[model samples]
Structures are given as C-alpha cells and as structure tokens.
Target chain A: QQQVKQSPQSLIVQKGGISIINCAYENTAFDYFPWYQQFPGKGPALLITIRPDVSEKKEGRFTISFNKSAKQFSLHIMDSQPGDSATYFCAASMRNDYKLSFGAGTTVTVRA
Target chain B: DTAVSQTPKYLVTQMGNDKSIKCEQNLGHDTMYWYKQDSKKFLKIMFSYNNKELIINETVPNRFSPKSPDKAHLNLHINSLELGDSAVYFCASSSAGGAETQYFGPGTRLLVL
Candidate 1:
C-alpha cells in the first residue's frame, strides 16, 4: 500500500506559468511532509517542506500549501522556468522515524 | 564537496554473482539510509543506520546485507544477485536524526543480467 499518493504523473507548463502538484497521505501519524526535486542523472534534493502546524509555507518562488485535516498538500512553483523542469516527489514520515514513504514521482516539463 | 557519495555509478553483473556498493558521507551526519528506486521511479527505504548502529531494516530479502564500518560510511552487499535486483540504489544522510532533511548521493544503477 502506498502511504503517499501524488497526482499528475507528468505535467507540462509554459514559461512564467504556475506549476502545481498535489499529494495526499493516508497515515495520520505522519507529521513531516517534504518535497524533493530531481534532475536528470542526479539524485533528488529537498525543495520545500511543511508541518501540519501551519497551513502554508513559502520560500522564494516555491510555496507549499498543506491541509492537515484532509491529509493533503500541494506544491506550487510561481513563474515556472525552463530550468525548473524535473521530477518531483512527495514524501511523508513521522517524527523520530527513520522510514520515509515516497510518492510515485511527477515529471514536470516547462516549455519556453 | 559532495555530502554523500556512492561508488560505481553503473554496474552490470551476472545473476548469482556477489556485488557490493559503497557509500560515504562528509556531512558528519549521525544518520544514514539506503534507498532503492525501481524503473517506475518508486523509491523505497531499505535500511537506516545511526551512529554505526542498525535502526531500521525493511522487508528486504536476506541476501541483502548492510554494513557500516563507521559513522561516515555505509555499504550494501548482495549475495546471489537476481535479475529482479536491477535498480538504482541511493545513499542518504541527515543531521540529528530521522524526520530531518536528507542529502542524497547521485545513485548507483545496478543491472543484474
């Protein structure tokens, strides 16, 4: 069973457009939610993360909207650029737990 | 400097052969983990070690063994490799403990022929 589920297995967005990816989790014990971005031939890097205590968190052009009640979260990239094209993965884990359950990854392509 | 690094970026070996992948981290993190990514891009956790102590071991087969000689290094050894063992393995490290941000290595692509 997949603990985390992400939508839009693949997405295409125009330059300067907004790119959004959504994810949901079934485990209520998961308190930490993180998003990762991966480029071709490279490992994934942490993008942004949020906890259930807050409804949203923004860093630069990236924003994470979280809904604890619904067990859902979404990542929005404002003014998406061509360089932002890559794969994104959403993961959830509980505090003090070493295991992280990752979502099936979404490949994003930005058209110039 | 690379925070996490894995050796043998690509490996192709025959079935039943024994192979080992080595990983090292320079971040001085107290926790390290091993993850496997399948062709469908599904990433799954295999094992986790903290301060050279085994902490997490998933439902992986007994043929797979993880060794940590010290706090800075973790290695995976597989005996009698099977075709299904083909996948990309990644090593990650985090400061403090679990539920923290993790730094990942580039990855090691293994192909069991």
Candidate 2:
C-alpha cells in the first residue's frame, strides 16, 4: 500500500485567514513528506517538507505538521493571502527511492 | 534561468499520430522523471531515469516510451496516440539521487482529437 490520500478536494478561505489541508499515507516506509504548490499553467513547486524525525516544520507563513505513528500530515498557511491561492499536493517517499506517492491534491482559494 | 524546461507548451494532434515532448533540466540533477496528469487532476508516474539509466517504469501503455539522451534531458514519445492520451505531461528532475527535492517543468498540455 503506497497511496497517500488527501482530503478537502477544494477549499475557500477569506484573505488574512488560515488555510489548512490534511493528508494521510498507508506506507510505513515513507520517511520524507513534501508539499507542493501549483499555479494555473505552471509546474508544481515544492512548498514545504518535513521528515519523520520532526513533529513540525515552519517556513515563514507555511507550516507542516507531521505525525509519524499516525502516518498522517497536514499543511497550514497562516494569514493566507490571495497570492497563495493554488493547488496543493502532498507526497511521500522513502530514502533511496525514486518513486514518490502523491495525494489527490487540494485546491485552496484565499479570496480577497 | 529555468531549472526545468519543456517544449511545445500546448499540442493538438489527431489520434494515431506520433508526437514527442522534449525536456531539459539545468539544475545539474542526476535523476529525472515523467508524470502524467489526467483531466481529473490525478498525477501518476510514468517513467524515471537516473543518470541516463532507466530506473522506474510504471504500469503504462506500451505506446508510451521515454528516452534520455543525457543526464539533464528526458523525452517522451507517444506512438499511436489515443484520445485518452490527451492530458498534461510534466517533466521533473532532482539532484544527487533519490529522496531529493524535485524541480518541475511548466508542463505540456496535449490534446488528442
């Protein structure tokens, strides 16, 4: 079982509010978790990532909460801005593995 | 400079036609991969190449083939294109080896009519 499932196919939040997206994986071998942000007509870019060793990782306004035992993770954007509106995808992979299992994806719209 | 780049951002072709999409990476990554995103927004891996060697080949149709002339380049060639082949194809690359951050190309939107 190498699937990563994400919830809330789409989300809408008011500007300056908080946007949260959740993801879960069935593969226990996954050690690295990454989130990606994609804009219309553009490639998906790495937003933030966390490892099993860390419970949480924050970079500026983006934060990732990871639970190793539960095999779940989530992405939180504080003070969400309209510019942050895009599709977010969560993926999991193991060390020395080239294949990355990805979730369905979540489209977050921070309206102004 | 663009870390990853793909040619023919949009392509429209008839079924059964053969077409090729080219990809290049300037990020000096040793590994590269190809992913297909369907109309339903599901992204799936098709093939992966590391240092010009075939590494991962998913359960994709035989009509789809991947070629890597160099470590920084990977191309996808589709023979006998079908209507189901219409989708966005993305090319991504990573540095060092596995479990590394990947850089993606803008993507190529293919429409098989």
Which 10 successive residues of model 2 chain B have the least lDDT summed? B95-104
* Tens digit per residue, CA lDDT, model 2, A6-110: 988999999999999999988788898999999988888999889999999999999999988898999999999999999999999999799888899999999
lDDT of 2 by residue, B1-113 (tens): 98899998999999999999999999888999999998767789899999999999999999999999999899999999999999999999998454788888999999999
- Model 1 misplacement above 4 A: none
Q: What tens-digit string does per-residue lDDT give for candidate 1 at A1-112? A: 8899999899999999999999999889999999999998899999998999999999998999999889999999999999999999999999978888899999999999
* lDDT: worst 10-residue window of model 1 chain A: A92-101
Fnat for model 2 comes to: 0.75
Q: Largest DockQ belongs to which candidate?
A: 1
Instruction: Look at candidate 1 and tell me the lDDT of residue A94.
Output: 92
Q: Compute the DockQ of candidate 2.
A: 0.78
Clashing pairs in 1: none
